[model samples]
Target chain A: MNEKKSSAGLKLCISDLSMSFGGVQALEGVSFEVEPGTIHAIIGPNGAGKTTLINCISGQFIPEGTMHFGERELTHVRAHNRIQMGIARTFQHVNVYSELSVLDNIMIGGHHRLKSNWIRQCLYWGPYGCSREEQMLQAEALELLERLEMRHLADSPAGELSYGQQKRLEVGRALLAHPKLLLLDEPMAGMAKQEKKQLSDWILDINREMNITIVMIEHDMTVVQTLSDQVVVLDFGRKIAEGPPQEVVKDKRVRKAYLGED
Target chain B: MEPNLTDKDAGTAAARPLLETRLERYGAVGLILALAVGSMLISSYHLSLLTTITIFAFSAMGLNLLSGNAGLISIAHAAFMGLGAFTAAWFAIDLGIPILIAIILAGIVSAGVGLLFGIPSLRLSGLYLILATFAAQIILYWFFEQALWLTKSPDGRFVGIPEVMGFEFGDPWHYYLLVLVFTIAGAVVYLNILRSGLGRSLEVIKERPIVSQMMGVNLQRTKLIAFTIGHFYAGVAGALYGWHLQFVATEAFDLMGSIELLVMIIIGGLGSLAGAVLGATFIVVVPELLDMAGRRLVDDMGLMAPIRMFIYGLLVVIFLIYEPHGLARTWRKLVRYFNKKLFKNKNEH
Candidate 1:
């Protein structure tokens, strides 16, 4: 495969990262590079360990090997700290603050970058003044909300949104973290065909407009075909195929893995 | 992503009442104002009871932050308060520290002890944490009773009255005002913290600690803060209670006292600050009211009146099962129901 040209000023390099729970190895000797400003897809059937790989990269597991975003080592980083390094992810299933307003859900993602101290916040008056910091954070959060076409539901509780809307809101939240690298786990899962189309368009828009390097795990072949700049297939926690979507889709092993035949 | 928000929805809509209510944080402020004004008008004895209720209410509010918001139940808050009371007494007696300064020091020292006990919470939870607090109550109660070098052994009455700023705090009225100021201020800070980012983080931890950790909220740090703050508030309340009565013993701050505070929160409402006040008032005043009713019944109808404690216990259980949302939710529903029935909107008509 050709070494793809980098564009979004980020190249995530993972080498020999492995993890095990008890005696069962979740991932072993997994190595891959997601080129900058491109959609790198990881596809697999049920229990193929796609989510585990995402978990490892997202700091949920302390892996045995190095995972680097640009030049910084991510193998030992905490999940939230990774956001500051421009790494963000959405769960395969929607994980969001249900009781909070849609706007506040985004604000939570923005909280990582907030500079306000507890002292200033507690007193309601301080040397730095919490009101000023709070207003600015709110402004930024509302801006991200509008971009995701969720401004109308800003005040609505996040749980009130439909599945598709919640998915969009999750994406909006990840964006609010100001990530240069976004890992979307099954962004198109459980969405209607039209909803999938809308989400796909937005994902592409984000990549094009904001130039975010997106590493997505998609089960839907149609989504992978339409959106990914490159594809990497995993099965039973092993890399099955890696290349452009057209090349990877035509591979015998890739077809057999998806179709369940040799 | 940088999303441009300035170009959209700048002034397109009227603010919803609910959203405005969140922004205004009217609940805490409104409750304090109403209670303060109401307290001033009551008879002096009731005013004293009101002061007790306020102190207990603030203590409950602190616990609510830890137990209700942060999902760490505590049964040892009263012990923390006891520590504060004795610390203040010891300081006032041995060091001759001013009452206000002593109270502050008591809160700080109690918070230090609270921090130590809270360390176990990093590894313990639920009934285990409750058990840990029970152990704390027993240990502290023993120390208060037996530690002669520090507390002068039983009958902890060596502590003198507190006077500060040239104003004697020995008077019931003076102490009541002092309690009122501190309780109101404590309630205000608690309300703000509940509405702030820390509140969200606590709720997040309560619902999903792993998710909260992944979201970048430090679980141990957040919980430590909750435990310390809760203990600090309880300590302040105890210190104030000690000085007001000018007499305190192990009996004043014991395991049953901790249980009573828990019952107050549970009966009033678990998560609502307003419920803390309602619960504290109910716990403090209802017994006296029942006693008066019992005496009247015996005098007029030739019946017994001393079964009030049994009735109070029954009320707690019934409320727990029947209206688990507590009196605050019930009160809200009643208000809303009357508002709808009494004042139908002209638009609806």
Candidate 2:
């Protein structure tokens, strides 16, 4: 919020974050800072706790450390309440409501933002009631779909879409929440080169235009190097290197952990 | 489905804005008129049949919202109905409340009970939730039989002639109108909920609970609300049933009755409102159909009963194996087919 390098979005601060599943440690003493409005990518090889780190930040897992989003501490926040504080996330795999229409799937993402409750929703026919709210949400969903180039698939069930489309649908769903901090787990997973290129462009557009800070777990080092402003390399649940993308990717520890190097 | 352009025609029927169209404006009025006209045209015996179907359909619609849409199964819905019926009886006989007011109040009482039972759903789901609700069915059924204060007797308590707004419902036709009004209201509410964000939240919670929670849907609150509303529907149906038979009994709210409600929603279609209505009608008519078939086809009474029962079991199997989605999906397919043909003809014209 200060003269902190074009920081219009929330500053995400994670310090000494550690988590374990019983005997197996998923993340350990991992720490990183995501500058506001910056595209911060968490990259690692298999079993490197990149997804775990994303989950911890999104309040899926309670890790041992401090996670501050702007002024508030999100260490003990419930998963449902996380989005209320402008923290929205996509799953590593497709976790969208596939049974619902693409538009409805996105509309449901903004459920917390909707003003109508049980009474208003049940009695939706009063003067300027839930019906009006529904129309507004519907329009917003359609617009988001249009942006995603999925306007034609608005009425189609999410299950009917291609794997790449489903991934994009998940992103669009997360976007509908209007989160200040967007956590994307493998946004380019199962995508073709062309699809990845398009998604990378879209990510940059979302960061610059929407002023949302993004923390993404990416397997593709090429994408990690190209798209991210900052990069954190994790090897076996520990942060190996963290800096600007170019600097971190060139680090000896990062190269040893990520690429096949001595 | 067409592989083509036309951004102007991007909207599908589902994509259309909820309740924004002129057709949807008069939707409630149209629904009431249909129910009223349908009831008026039926004879006494048919009126009784229609009323029974309507009452069951009303309850199944409630179950459908929970089991069908929310993906939460409850085998204790009949007990909810029983609770409502008994509560209505208490209001009418003990407190001297208006039957109409009593019915609504009875629903509220059932809803409260539903919320109590729905607590187990927070930690339990799928088979566990079913078992939990099954326990609810048994426990609530026992309460109905033993609670002398409500039931008045082990046999049953007879509900008096239901009077609403000075109009006594002594005639079967008069009572049928009351049930019709409630069923219409149920259908309307069911539709309204499905279109609204609240309904969509339950749906998301059903399909993807983690994602739903991450999206900020309070899982516990949503599930409880569903149970409360779903039980209210069951309760209203029970009250109507009580008034229809002039009796409220534990026998009617037993485990078998709960299974019957479950079958109604499953056979009709899980999530479809029409499925709830159709399933109720199917269940009500099937027994009458079996009896009629048995009498016409066989001479010996004992043999006829077994033969009819075998056929009934066979029919259920055939429906499940073939139409797993239920009657609503089949009905939708037929409607879609007819619409397509109609559109083709229109194009030619």
Candidate 3:
């Protein structure tokens, strides 16, 4: 079945983004560019401000930075508006609406795409359009569930899912937004080895099939080396290494940051 | 590779709506019919009780949506009702606006005022929303009491007997039917809204505002809309209430009224329209039944004031502890049990 997704990814450019909490500088003049339709992984140790950088790109932070998605400047765009511009993200922790059905939780990601006059929609008049819009959305969400091979679990509450499955649900929810740029904050964190491999494959599928640019923050070096086309390593709130995954792993500063000074 | 589920559970899954669609399809009609039957079969003596249940349910359904989906418990809901009743009464009585138009206008005006109070919901929720709306109730009641020109009398205000075309809804049965139509309309509208995109947003907003916002749902706007729609229902219900009693009194729409609506929604269930109706029925009918029993036992008109409050508090505790999802979840469980039991009995037969 043909999937209706956002037209291929946009160039995500982040420049001079510096954010600090009081004296605790989480990200300082951190800059990176993610080419369209590629997986760009950011690797860092504990408190390296990896998540902070992702948050900034996803409009969760207003750091001293200029962000450009395609031609649109997102320096001042709010979180919700960033999603409107096709920037969707998953949290570091799995954040599914536990009380909702699996399908219902995914459908929440598509609500902003609902385009109908608010007044007419409220009345539920057939010709007024929102009812029809929702029917189409339900079908779309169901199709997405089917593609994720989670069609049978559609009726079950999200809380009942295993931890790894919850992570996948969070990713599925993000995908439903038809994001041009997907920011995954620690997508592999806290997953079993097999689950990590499975999620890495799913991330690859999301990138290839949807033609979406992915900015993932991960600590799994093996998974990152295999999946990502490019890599940026951060240590102490600063970019220490940038190149192909294999080269970045061998960089002097990156090795020193991970293994301590030689 | 994924979690395993039994086939029996799959059957239940097939019966479920993604969210609120099934209720609109079957439950909404079933509720309206049951009330219609109640109107016919019940004694004219209890006709007023039936009418009051539907009227309260109209607004209770609104609170049901706000509290159930948005996770907002509004203590000022009754105050908004008071606002609508007064606005509709003022338009109809003072300015001589068409009564039906005035009622609709009253709903809009109440929504506007509710939006003002709902601003607090943007920064707060749960117990905090209750506190914020509590202040709203007190403030609105103060306005209702002090605005002598609106009521035309310092004591209370009276509205004319409602007339449409040549027919007058002066009789109890006629008034019941009129209120019934409005309540049914409210139910249908509530169902439709729930089955749509706005309903989806509220569901996510309730669970996690951060997730909803990340998905491009304007969190502030959605919460405000919940407040708006909830108050719109309160206003319409208040207008119908005004005509039902032929009076707009501050005492009727006080903290007690808001508490009563909250109790109805909680006891019935939060998210479902069916729960809202059942809750309204339980809250209204149980008390009146007790009142009747008390009257026969004591030979007194003032049978319950303090006693009723104690009962509501107790019932809320019982429901919250035993069936936290409220009566809707219980209703679903019963339906599922019967479906299996009846099928087994048929196979045996």
- Residue B68 of model 2 has an lDDT of 89
lDDT of 2 by residue, A1-262 (tens): 1222454567889999999999988899998898887888988898999998988888778899999998999999898999988899999988878889998898876777777778688777776347766766677778789889999998799999999999999888888888888999999988899999999999988887787888999989889877788888898899989888879868998778788798
Best of the candidates, DockQ: 2
Residue B272: error of model 3 in Å? 1.4
What tens digits encode model 2's per-residue C-alpha lDDT throughout B72-92? 999999999999999999998
CAPRI band of model 2?
Answer: acceptable
- What range of 10 consecutive residues in model 1 chain A has the weakest lDDT sum? A1-10
lDDT tens string, model 1, B106-206? 99998888889889778788788888888888888888888776567676764555688777766666677788888877876776666566766777778
Off by over 4 Å in 3: A1-8, B1-31, B293-303, B339-349
Q: Mind sharing the TM-score for model 2? A: 0.92
Which of the predicted structures, 1 or 3, would earn the higher DockQ when compared with the native? Answer: 3
lDDT (0 to 1) per candidate: 0.77, 0.84, 0.81
Q: For chain B alone, what TM-score does every candidate structure achieve against the true structure?
A: 0.84, 0.87, 0.87
- How far out, in Å, is residue B7 in model 2? 24
User: What class would a CAPRI assessor give candidate 3's docking?
Assistant: acceptable
Minimum summed lDDT over a 10-residue window in model 3 chain B is located at B1-10
For candidate 3, the TM-score is 0.91
Q: Candidate 1, which segments miss by more than 4 Å at Cα? A: A1-8, A126-128, B1-41, B293-323, B331-349
